[model samples]
Target: MKKTINSLKIPVVFLLLVSAFIACDKDYSVIESDVLGDENSDFTTGDSLWSVTAYNKKLDSLQINNLGTTSISATAGNLLGVFNDPSYGLTTASIVSQLVPSTFSPEFDENPVVDSVVLNIPYYNTVVSYDEDNNPEYRLDSLFGDNDTPIKLTIYRSNYFLRDFDPNNPENVSQKYYSNGSSTENSALNGTSVIKFDDHIDNISNPIYSNAAFKPSNLATITTVGDGDDEVATKSGPALRKLLDNDYWKSVIIDKEGDPVLSSQSNFKNYFRGLYFKAEANTNDGSMLLLNIAATAANITMYYTSGADGSRTQETYVMNFSGNILNTFVNDYSIPLYDGDKILGDNELHLKGTEGSMAVVEIFSGKVDCDGDGILDLDAIDCFKQNYRQLDDNGDYVKDPITNRYKLKKLINEAQLVLTELDNLPTGSVEDYHTYDRIYAYDIKGNSTTLDYSIDPTTNTSDPLNSKIISLGQRNDTGVFKIRLTQHLNNILFTDSIAENTPTTIGLVLSNNVNYTDNAEILDSGDTVTTVPRASILSPRGTIIYGSTQNTDPKKRLQLKIFSSEAKD
Candidate 1:
């Protein structure tokens, strides 16, 4: 038989062509579309479908999965591929002709992003109303005795039917009455809420005792007024407490103009959006990033926005009193083609500085103008440079020190006065400490000097002339001592008169006197032996020289005694 070389060659050639066709089909799977099947055709792979098409569907699903987990960079070209809605119905399937380069471009997510940065500032003053009868027809009062009538202020999603009031019959709107202890059934209410009560009834009563009655003056609107609701004019819906929780509020300088002046100093301000620190490497180079505080105040705001590549990119941030970012940025916090910088995480600004693990960010160069003129701001004063007190007398950052000193002095003086009064009380009085004469004297130098008048005058050597008591001697523990009067007493010895005709040093002579330990004795020119006092003369003198016995004897058995009424030491 002729060896069939042609037949063998043909078979081999056919096999080679088949193998090439299979290999080409595998490569085409990468770019294959779902167009081959009818709209109702199951996307699920089955043995019945062409192998190439089935293989392509499997590859397509893997690509979709990979895209979901990948995070794109801000500077990267938009690589999201295809605007086909994952939620599209079968009827909306793309036509074969619609496939083109422009149509294949990735769709950017344009959903409105809410700025998480939110602040809740309470209206300074609050209000509430009460009804006495608890019924539709009853007397109402704002002043409910000394007891504080408690009320809850609620924030709501909208102004959905709070309650309708019939002024003619207030009981019709009794549902809106502030919940008090007696009205337990009316407590539940729907709205974001806050609560406060006067420690005692605020006494909003008119003392005139009029017959007129007052109910809650309608539901007080949220406001910043000293005596109003907690609503801000710009904010709608029920007043909420959760929103007020992390808001940074500045002192209202000229409060007369309705709204409270918002905090302008970024150093004192905070954005409390939800976020925290975790150890991570940078996207570009995987370098270690140190998280640290850049300023005293929690001023940073996290700028979160969607990138063109369908991934979120966040810029670590801080802002001043005004919505100005501290660190460098291509522009202000305003999002390009978006509303007030779509904040993420619930319209609440997260305070990264307070959390302590926040990453430190450099202030943007555009925000740091150094000519003493402001940066990126029309006014020379930067947002961070606002004077809270608004006083720039010396142009120094610190408010004037003069007022502080005066304030300190006034406080000290008030404290001293209070302490002085306290000292005068029984618990702290001088008598308690045995310092009766707590006369504190001040001299030219404001130094203190003390005098203890509680002591006897004779023992006190603090200058009796400078002292108050005129007497030199006082009754001592021992018997009294007497000196005979003489002209010399007036000069140097003894005399009854303060002035003497002539000066003389009179000699000392002891006058007859009663001894504390013995019977009385008398001294006379003839009776040196004390004959006058010898029993007979001791008798009551019957002789009446004047109205009674003269008893010329210096002492004739009479004893001298003194009684002191002062409580004994």
Candidate 2:
């Protein structure tokens, strides 16, 4: 049963005072006690049994571009390669990035000749130990799936231009892109008729770079230059450093020096376009990597020599992966059917990342019977008002004469949403762990963080992973997630008017980092689900958990448990 609270008149001055008091940094336990009177002398604490409904919702398309009007790149890392999940099926990640020349249209020495072009994209790694010779041993981080298995990698010259502002919008809004390349809406937004991989300039017949079988290695790279006593060695962490064809760079860049196309950034971008890093599965199970492609170390260097053969000087030109960079995902997963009871909620909740799935949770839904007469008389909100509000001699609500609203008799101390994972499901293979460490909750309508999440005292601004871990809740050893909603619930129950302060639906999704609260636009949803969690776009993982309709074990069902305090009267 469910219920909603009706509009009740409340004192504006009193509500203002309570709002002001809640904004302070004092401890909630002492604050609530002082606001509602002494706990031992006048108040008693107890739990409110409220109904919660939760169901799985699939995400068709999610925004991938981090390009804003003021910010160049808001995302942390770009995902690459393919991974096959036991439950969520296959996912392929690719990158489309715009490149900028280190120096625009500069005069090269007379008769310049291309020597080699080297592309270096650094991997997330850490130095574990140092050898006797002072060489460091490194371990790769941010890699998922099977490291031993190889995946097909291809780099192509992109013909499609990634614009900074939307041409269709009059206000010059920043152009947005989604992860799903198959979406016709996204194709239309790009002003291109072709979809997916067809947007690239190169084909299978002739690509910039192609490797049918490619895998990442953890060993440090050692480059030696010169010979004999003059020889020197440089050791660096593991990275994707490969030499490209010199003929290709000579024809594309060297031959066009001082041309009108290379004069400025606007003209250069249209002439060169960019590079597309496409990933394909070579085997049934492949590897995925989180690449720091926007880092200063990630760039393409063109090594060349200028001047006469007898007096040649070595020169280097660099191109950086910058401007408008975005990630594209090709997901092959069985879309879960939504036939479950909406009021009671579904039996299973599916939570996945990277244009995957999310869950909608509604608390205190529908009407409920307050009295034990076996008849539905009032809704849950009305029941809360009747049971927790002050009563008169005739057992009716004691209304304020000035405001004509029933005053709140109980103060909400804490409200927590508990989600338990399904133990029987296979999370991942023995080689890799696919389950996420944290799940974020936000207001569905506002597409923003809850009051509790915003006011979490333990939030560490410097370290994203450590921020709000206790308040937002991490996946425990038993596979349970607990999220606090104290301030959010208090706002709803203690508000002066029900019309303005009704309970809102909550959204739960897997987060790569809790500190990232920014929302990314959805392509085809037409602003209905306006945005998705930005942190969720960085990960490629999934998990299954119990919803609100677990019949076999009622205790395992999703619940909104609220601890409140009321006057001893």
Candidate 3:
């Protein structure tokens, strides 16, 4: 946004802006201009492309979770599917701020309006500086500090970027970079030149405490309070406000409607870091826990390399997590950071060339310590279990299995038995998984020369085909199951090799020829033994047959038949 005061060139010069609207004829639509200074036009008629109050109001509309509620719905199950029920934790406002869409318009323009814009969002920080002796001194009220506490310096790093899109190219649309390298000027739009916001502080009653003061480099400036604003101390604590001059905190002003004042050294377009809010030891308290919440925004900076065709393109790194800070601290407080004190979160941004041209990739690789307990969230076993469920094979809920490998293996073995039918077979019970009954036909063999089962038999009336019919009662349920004693083999007997011996137990002597005496007798001998297989009525249903290769004889085959009982109703 740029502004300049110049001499009036023409008395009747008419400034016209073409806007899209429905035509009165209904058949055609076109861009038409309404006179800017027309007498009948409403004062608020023109589009408000760049307005600060409206923008600030929009920022204020972002929500936060408060501790005051009695009962709450699970945020993960309710809001955005992020937090789960038992793990009802959220990020601090700083972390949540990252979720704010980079391309959103606050102004309610009926039609799309394009305008260069600027906005300033405030933040608090704990400033540390060096004294003349090279010893570390602390400032608590610079742009990063709190004034009401014993802190001396407070400061903030403001993020700046373009808000509107370029009408010329679609790919160069409303994408926000940073204001680190821009040559834009820093001034205020309204004449008041001052903006104040709330920054919380802790007194002596708080858990943490500190009192220090120091200065900063030219990157920021501080303003003093004047005699007229003595009433500002009403809330700033009795001795707290008097420790510094009137302009203890600097007021950052960026002139939007004028030429850019930021020099190229600033690199506004590439400044992708986050605003870290450091606290003085005096104001430390439990505020560090506040930073651990997921509501806090994890800052991300996207890097890109422009393509040779004068268009933009993404690189091979589809995306990555840069780093995340709890936005809060815990346990101890000092002017500077320590090695083990900082808790970093995964928050790399997604960078892509043309490969990611389709849809944005959702890469999750960040951690949040919403409670600020010094322990990483992932390492907290209870916290992890509360937030995530154990998924079964069907993607349904199930109890979390024991972590011991042996215990898990046993449980898996038991689970597989539920899918088998051995429990319902003969002499079978649920607990009888290890039991087996008497073995029958343990050493059975098939006919060596034929695929079908056949037995050698008597040469005369007792046919080999009839002797081969060894009935084994099989309960089959496929279609209709009926038992039939049939000749299983095609041949009756061979010519010269075999014959039947005289039978001993004679029942009836009947012959076709009266002169000849021929009768068949039941024979009970060591070589001939028989057992009639039993069969009971089986209500018809479906059946499944399992055919397996004989384990004893590799070439032998066996089949199992299963039947479904008919419903008793």
Question: Which candidate wins on TM-score?
Answer: 2
Question: Model 3: residues >4 Å from true position, as ranges?
Answer: 1-153, 158-276, 283-286, 289-569
Indicate the residue-level lDDT of 453 in model 1: 15
Q: What tens digits encode model 3's per-residue C-alpha lDDT throughout 1-569?
A: 01110111111122111101211121111121234343432221211010000000000001112111112111110011011001111111122111122222122212222221111221222336655865444432111112222322232332422223434456874322111101112111111121111122222232111225422222222322234855232111011111211111111112211223222212222232222233333333111111111222221212223334545443211111112221121111111111110122111111110000000111111243536687546423222222223335794434324532111000000000000112133211223311211010100011011111122121122211122112211122221111111111111111111122211111110011111111111112121211100000000001111112122221111111111111111
- Please list the residue runs of candidate 2 whose C-alpha ends up more than 4 Å from where it truly belongs after superposition: 1-42, 67-75, 181-194, 221-232, 308-311, 334-341, 385-407, 431-436, 460-465, 496-503, 526-528, 550-552
If both were scored by TM-score, which would come out higher, candidate 1 or candidate 2? 2
lDDT by residue (tens digit), candidate 2, 387-484? 66766779876666786655566656567788888876675646225334578998877778987887776666544555676467766667778787
Tell me the deviation in Å of residue 524 in model 2.
3.4
Highest lDDT scorer: 2
Model 1, position 167: C-alpha lDDT score: 50
Evaluate all candidate structures by whole-model CA lDDT and list the values in order.
0.17, 0.72, 0.18
Ranking by TM-score: 2, 3, 1
Query: Following a full C-alpha superposition, what root-mean-square deviation does model 1 have from the true structure?
Result: 53.0
